[model samples]
Target chain A: MTTSPIADALRLPAGPVDLTAIETDAKPGFDGKKADGKGALFAMGDELADLQERLWAQRTVGSERRVLLVLQGMDTSGKGGVLRHTIGLVDPQGVRITSFKAPTDEERAHDFLWRIDKGLPPAGYIGVFDRSHYEDVLIARVHDLAEPAEIHRRYGAINDFEARLADSGVAIIKCMLHVGADEQKSRLAARLDNPDKHWKYNPGDLDERASWPAYREAYEIALERTNTDVAPWYVVPADKKWFRNLAVAQLLLDTLRELDPQWPVADFDVEAEKKRLAEESPVQ
Target chain B: MTTSPIADALRLPAGPVDLTAIETDAKPGFDGKKADGKGALFAMGDELADLQERLWAQRTVGSERRVLLVLQGMDTSGKGGVLRHTIGLVDPQGVRITSFKAPTDEERAHDFLWRIDKGLPPAGYIGVFDRSHYEDVLIARVHDLAEPAEIHRRYGAINDFEARLADSGVAIIKCMLHVGADEQKSRLAARLDNPDKHWKYNPGDLDERASWPAYREAYEIALERTNTDVAPWYVVPADKKWFRNLAVAQLLLDTLRELDPQWPVADFDVEAEKKRLAEESPVQ
Candidate 1:
């Protein structure tokens, strides 16, 4: 039951990833329509909260294990929406979200992974990267921010880095939200249509949209290059926002269930403590 | 309608404050029972989400305003419960929650406020401190960690620090979750009884419980000394967990409604961008 078909279907296969071949609007593993999808997600909330607490409780037993969710997508791919609707289901205290914008000068001065290393979740926490070190490859390759050799080297470096994280007990979930060009245009236009959404629209999103083809190729290159067993990639069909949220959430749920974090046993003498409370700590 | 009677009723008045005089189980500003209280909190979710987004959107327009909610209380006073139930209502992205534990060597090396300054929310965010700078006075006083004069000086230092934060547009909400000693005994007993909750129990909590009177005196003195116009303290009767959650959520809602953040106006031409998107960026 922990095995989600969505995870199996949406997971990028070992050989190559073609951004064009996947139908952007297709609901890959879900059988029903929108309402059912939402209801299914809603039903998972209690279990999600339970599993997250168990994961968080592991820290008390000196477990360093944590989950880092890396979300990468083109503009208007609904990363924020997923964060609010999906990750928002759990207690915010147990979740740490870091949204990476353009690197600050201090960040640029360090290795691309340095800032990311700093943002990693602590023991018993779920760390989310809205955009992450993958940017070092995706945007770096697209904008030619680094030399060709350096850009080429980042792929290996990322793999090695994630491998170390895996060894040290980090469950990495990498998602590439795959929205079609038409979908992107409409989402951007909707930002223009609504005053409440204008804050989310950036003119630079247009620049990124114009280079959609390049970005797709860059993603394909990055995804194919760094798709390791430790941190595999999921190409969520982002044209449908609900499906994107549900898939990511289901992916997280599946992972948590697999981890199967158990509540830590009491280190103290529970019976003795209970006795002490009864005797020494009477109602005041 | 924007104002909450809960905020006004819970807010500690300007004068000598007495923790013992307050009833820990009484529901102030709320006439309903637990189910109705939970219903009221659930009803506030949409407004909370909307207001949080407005506050978050302010960052787009270069607004520096943010709100900081500092929760301080004895063990099992339900600070964690409030965080899970109340602050959990809004988008976690817009919130920055810091749980202040015993100071590290590095944290202790720096001025007390240095670590606190580092934890402050960035512009346009709601920052929550499960335990905060007030620990300097409360714990320092109880354990005699600092000189008598040094502890006295910290009150002024904290007031000045908050005044500066207020001047820079940080609306501060400090809540002291006042749970009675008898209720705390039962809660501690419950933690000892449940294996699932054992991770949350620390044997040291019993030691702290033994020093309850000292801690209460410390809180009383700390509240009296540092409570200011810039950052007032609200004594939330936390014996009823539902009321505690609802009251704090309402306080946040009241503050957000007062700020009444508007969605940022787009700096770019909406019509022109729509045209460019439609013409240049067609479906692939």
Candidate 2:
């Protein structure tokens, strides 16, 4: 798929961003590839692997740098694809992933952050939240998880929560996988049409579709309120799955590269240890 | 680095076997090749990328296949190396890792299973526990997490808990990294000798060393009690880092391949979607 040159040039806001501008500027069909035919997925994969290694090493050496990746998106927005591709590049030990479903009674008993806090990555670990704390502001606001006034309050609370986590040495990267309405409808239809994927289809998704404008408005407001310098949101173009993954992976790699942890030297004498092993052998 | 031919030819048991016999009989060294020969470190970098992709795919489809990787070991058993290598092969999106640290007040409040249950992988996810529920039996019996009688109960509970999770479709792979006492002493000494790693050196670890025979007894009991057909434990040789990683990775990949989830197909009309995209593009 091809995106317009103008749309292609649009850079996602790095820190606090104007939600209206972000929404408007984020064209749905923006092609991740230019005429060069180079897709971002492969590049991102390579970089992600490198970053994961560096991060894993840091953890091994007792450096407590934690990273929280928040992925928020509309249906068919390539969240899954991006997640799949990005994780493909990292060490499994240093990473954790959590996907939030409807709030169970136990979850609803606690404040919104309760379940989330439990899922946070340990020091020097990476935690990926498929849908995260932002759900309070997004779905809750749309479905009335709270009063409108309370929803407004959640925005600030979430911002503070993420900022505090960032201040405590956690790197937060929030990606809003942006897709077009047409794309969402088609993808939703695909779910309905396929026998194997029927499990993923929900009648309520279409009900939400009728209120797309409201959800979009809620998303814009949430983005406006929560986007911070310490914990920023990236409005990634998600029409292309490969590009989305590549972009997120690159972003992750770039962030870790900035951390720049050094590999610690192994303290053992290799030759001496080998000799000791040989001497200890019964046959030897 | 290579094992004797006689040792290589020996057949090992697939079920519960003596660690000493396996160590003596099996070929030494990891069969898994590093992605690149910057030693294990560089190979780890490459493997992370591959893992990320697989994880992302799992997450995208919302598949319920969860991976529970258990890393168990004695002190200085190269658990760190195994972790480094394993993490090097996964994507952060669908992967979650929890290292069982010393218990806290909150942990003590719950049954041994509670803390572990909180860390269990969601459907279509991968979860790694550095030291796991088995600790209830291993350390509990070794250091006495409970009374000797209570330890017996916990053993059954641990086994049942794992059996239930496996029945619920969790693919559990447990590795008991084996290292010689002399090798361990050398590693512990290395930690003390290196100023940078001094923080990791606890004098208490030496106290544990004094009770090595007791701990081994505890390990034997724990293995006998908990090694069910569903969650079989592999007593991995840890002296050779490369061989250990290869064995573990192969086991994991083989398990995942066995599950064999089909990739989500593109359900839209590819030609139409492409043509629509092209027609909509001004430049195209």
lDDT of 2 by residue, A1-284 (tens): 13233223433544444444544224343344442223544544555655665665567567778778888988768766665556645666656677787888999999889999887977877778888888888888888778988887788888888878988878887888777676676676676555555545555566566667777888878876776778766677666555566556655765676676555554445445445434443310
Q: Model 2, residue B135: what's the lDDT?
A: 77
**Tens digits of lDDT, candidate 1, A1-284:** 25698998898998788889998898898998899999988988999999999999999799999999999999888899999999999999999999998999999999999999999999899899999999988888889999999998999999999999999999999999888888888888888899899999888888777677788889999999999998999999999888899999999999899889999999889988887778885434
Model 1 CAPRI quality = medium
lDDT of 2 by residue, B194-222 (tens): 55555455556665766677777777677
* lDDT (tens digit, per residue) of candidate 1 on B1-284: 25577887888888788899999998899989999999999999999999999999998889999999999999999999998999989998999999999899999998889999999999999999989999999989999999999999999999999999999999999999999999998899888888899998888888788789889989998998878987988999999999999999998888899889998988989999888877783544
Worst 10-residue lDDT window for candidate 2 chain A reads A1-10
Question: List-wise, what DockQ does each model earn?
Answer: 0.74, 0.18
TM-score between candidate 1 and the true structure: 0.98
Give the residue spans of candidate 1 off by over 4 A: A281-284, B281-283
The alpha-carbon deviation from the true structure for residue B184 of candidate 2, after best TM-score superposition, in angstroms, is 4.5
Q: Give residue B1's lDDT in candidate 1 (0 to 100).
A: 27
Error of 1 at B29 (Å): 0.6
Clashing pairs in 1: none
